[model samples]
Target chain A: MDSLGLYVLAAAVLFGVGVYGLIVSEHLMRKLFAINIMGNAIFILLVAASGPVEGAPDPVPQALVLTGIVIAVSATAFALALMVRLYQETGQATLSSRDEGDDG
Target chain B: MTAEALALIVFLPLLAACAAVAFPGRWLGWIVRIGLLPLPVLMLAPTLAVLDQNVIHLALAGHASPLGIEWRLDPLSLLMLWLNVGITVLISLHAGVSFRPDSDRGQRFWPLWLILFASMNALVLSADLFNLYVTLELVTLAAIGLIAVESKPAALRAGMRYLLLALMASLLYLLGVGLIYGQTGTLDLYLIAEQIEPGWLPVTAMALMIVGLLIKSAVFPLHAWLPAAHGNAPGPVSAILSAMVVKVSIYMIWRLWFWGAAGWDLATAANLMGLLGAAAIVYGSLAALVQDRLKMIVAYSTVAQLGYLMLLFPLASTLAFQAASYHLLSHGLAKAAMFLAAANILSSVGTDRLQRLAGVDQRRPLDVFALALGGVSILGLPPSGGFVAKWLFLEAAWHQQAWGWLVLVAAGGLLAAAYLFRVLGVICLHPRKRLNRRQHREIPNLASVAALILAVSAIAAGFFSAPVLSLISAGLPPGVTP
Candidate 1:
């Protein structure tokens, strides 16, 4: 099989695993990791989708993946800050809102 | 000149966001106020360049499409751009008076606020799929930053949920973009439009992208994150989030579908979107009727109003498109006004509970008036922009002989009225318990003034739909033949 086919399959698998983690994990940190895995998976797909030229990587999707990486870093930082604050204010980082009252 | 102005519209806010951090504490408000100086430049400049008989495009870093970033201007972008500018200005006006300059919330709010404005303008102009993805990220990040500014448990938790969902949504969108790239070998929107082959690749790409956008736009079932995020954020944050931020993603969905996917024969997809629109309208309105908190009611109402915009996907005519565009601007104004007015009540009463809002009309008469006027447009009554949009939507549905959409739109409006009046009803009744002075801080005149002007203009916009419609139809985006 071609490199593109392998990349696509890998992206699909990583995305599936990440989605499962997001749904099954109660902890926000685990969820964040799942999201990062999903993000990296897409970046890989983006790079592989371009089809390598004479063994040299195309700059556009690489540039895109680089940009995506920066965005992901900042987003991760912000989400972590939010998780920290939620933990501080309410003393838990779990996603189970049904057990708790909103106004509390 | 127009190109420079368009470029300035996107860049000026980014510069200000960077400058806001350096500009020191007490003068931060002044810096923010100065940051908005370019808005008048944006408003006064005629953004369209059709007079030159040239295809309007701007290449960032002096690079062309496919290999470089690109921005394109058309009537739909201009319409949404104008709406974004107007709503942002009014929201800023309210926010300017809402907090002290050195306060923690104010400090946390300005930079992110400026970034969101820039991101939205960039999103409006971007014509390349990868550039669109970047802009979407910026928009989502800045919105989460704003939502979490309160540092309260509720706001923080809501912000986290919003972040995760928004991240997932964008990843799905990016995957679809990747799939299309695998097929087409390009990310330029118009290029993709011209070359899209009708097949499973396009079909799967469309499904994934649509689901992604639907989740980001908070169309029902995915809407649980919205109320807590919107309702708990401080007033101005909620105002901008509800009014302009959500509309950004929806606008992207429309732009992509119409410009790139319209030729792909999306009959089944379009019908499904129409059904989702119906479900969102009915479900959201019912949920709004049952919400006890004032902001919660407005947040749910936003879900229903978004349904009206989604109707265009199914109807897929020039008139339906125009009606959807008009409704977006009108609903945005009305919702922002309503949220700010709710903020006023929350500020005065120390809580937003329905039971605590007794005699709010008597207490903050102007704010109540603002709320009621905003509700009038939300209900799509005559002599308002909402009414014009509803009438146009009905006409579009009639022409298509889609009798079901006609009933859905009307019923949604009726249900909207039911919930809106429920809040106003509380205002007219006597308070079950008297509010002590601590709970009865006077509502600021500036707050009500901002809300009143926006609400009235939403009504006034009704009378002037002719010019706006002509403008949008006049400059229909490239690849979308009228």
Candidate 2:
């Protein structure tokens, strides 16, 4: 296989690992990490999949990756804030520990 | 001239959001009015342009497609813009009372609300896939933030779950965008449609994007997070979430299937989507029937009503498109009314528990009436917008001779009626003698009036169907023979 195929395969593996971690980890912080990892995997694929223009790496995907990173970072920050607030309110960082009967 | 109007339609609210952060207290209320009130007036230019010329395209930053971003406005997007403006303005009246811009909670609410408004306008106008992703994220984050703004443990928990799911969904959508860009080297939706070849890679990309959108739109099995999130949110927040936020993602799926991937033979996938809609209708209504809380029932109803939009894919005709688009409008109005009324009842009676809400109709007659009026549309009874949409849907199904879908559409309406009447019976009929006047808090009359107006408009939509239906037919997707 060529170098591009190798990179795509690597990104796929990373995405799988992120999804696995997101499911298995109970802590909200861990889930945030898992989401960021998944985002990085997609960023890699986005950059790797696009072919070079005139032997120079295409700039459009790079620009898109930069925007994606900004969005992912802001979303992670917001999620972390929510997680901390949740922990403070419920005395637990994991979502599973909360009782299901609370309606509002 | 149209370009300036389009720019203002998106940027005005964004500018207000910035001002909202800086100017707190009394000035904030005036700022919101200034920011939003002119939006409908501004829409007139674009509406006329679209009416005259079927579709209008504006290339942002003066560069054409495959390079700079493009904004396209057709009948469908024009309709969405009007819905967003109309609903947001009316709901703001309720928010004006509940949040009270002079208060701290109101301060936290208005900025995010305006930002969500701007992002949705941007989302509908955008012709690029990546731009849509950005706007989608903006809408999701703003919505979840609004859900958790109250900081109740329940609201916080619900918002957290929704945030996590939404983030994952965005990543899936982004991955698909990446794959499509790799294949076609263009992020423009129309350009991609023209350039894409039918193959595994493009097909895989479409599937991933659709699944991600399905989760975002809360269709069937993917809808576990919806009831809690919408149920726990503040009244105005829940109204917008159910009315427009979820609908926008479904709109994206429509654009992808009917416009972006128009040439691809998605017959099997379309059938699968229709089956999911059927399941959502059955499961959501049954779940709603057993719900003990008023808001949860309304939230579950949102999940069920969302299923009707999915039926368009399998029917795949001009009539189906019209039905689904009309459903979006009517559901937006009706659901917003129901949520606002539910919020008022909860505030007045101190709880929305169905058992505790006995005799609430005596104290909050207008709110109860609003809830019932909205339910009329939801049940697809005659002379409501929902009836018009459902009639179109049945016609489309009969024309195509799809018996299974035809039966499901009919059954879905009956299920809707069953749950809606169950709520009405409990609230209106199950009366306790001599309710204590001291315990009931009186909500402002304006709040209740806002909900009633929305409910009345949902009914009025049925009467004014001629012009809207004509607009929808004029803008049918590229491949459809309208």
Writing each residue's lDDT as its tens digit, candidate 1 over B314-336 gives 78777787789899989999999
What DockQ do you compute for every candidate structure?
0.58, 0.70
Kindly report which residue pairs in candidate 1 clash with one another.
B75-B475
Which candidate comes out best when scored by lDDT?
Answer: 2
The best candidate by TM-score is 2
lDDT of 2 by residue, B1-482 (tens): 99999999999999999999999868999888878899989999999999999899999879886657899999999999999999999899899999988899999999999999999999999999999999999999999999999898888989999999999999999999999998898898878998898899999998899889989999999999999999999999999999999999999999999999988888998999999999999999999999999999999999999999999989999999899999999999999999999999998887888878877888889999999999999889999999999999999999999989899889999999998898888777863654567878888999999999999999999999989999999999888853
| TM per candidate | 0.96, 0.98
Stretches of model 2 off by over 4 angstroms after superposition? A51-54, A100-103
Q: Each candidate's root-mean-square deviation in Å?
A: 2.1, 1.2
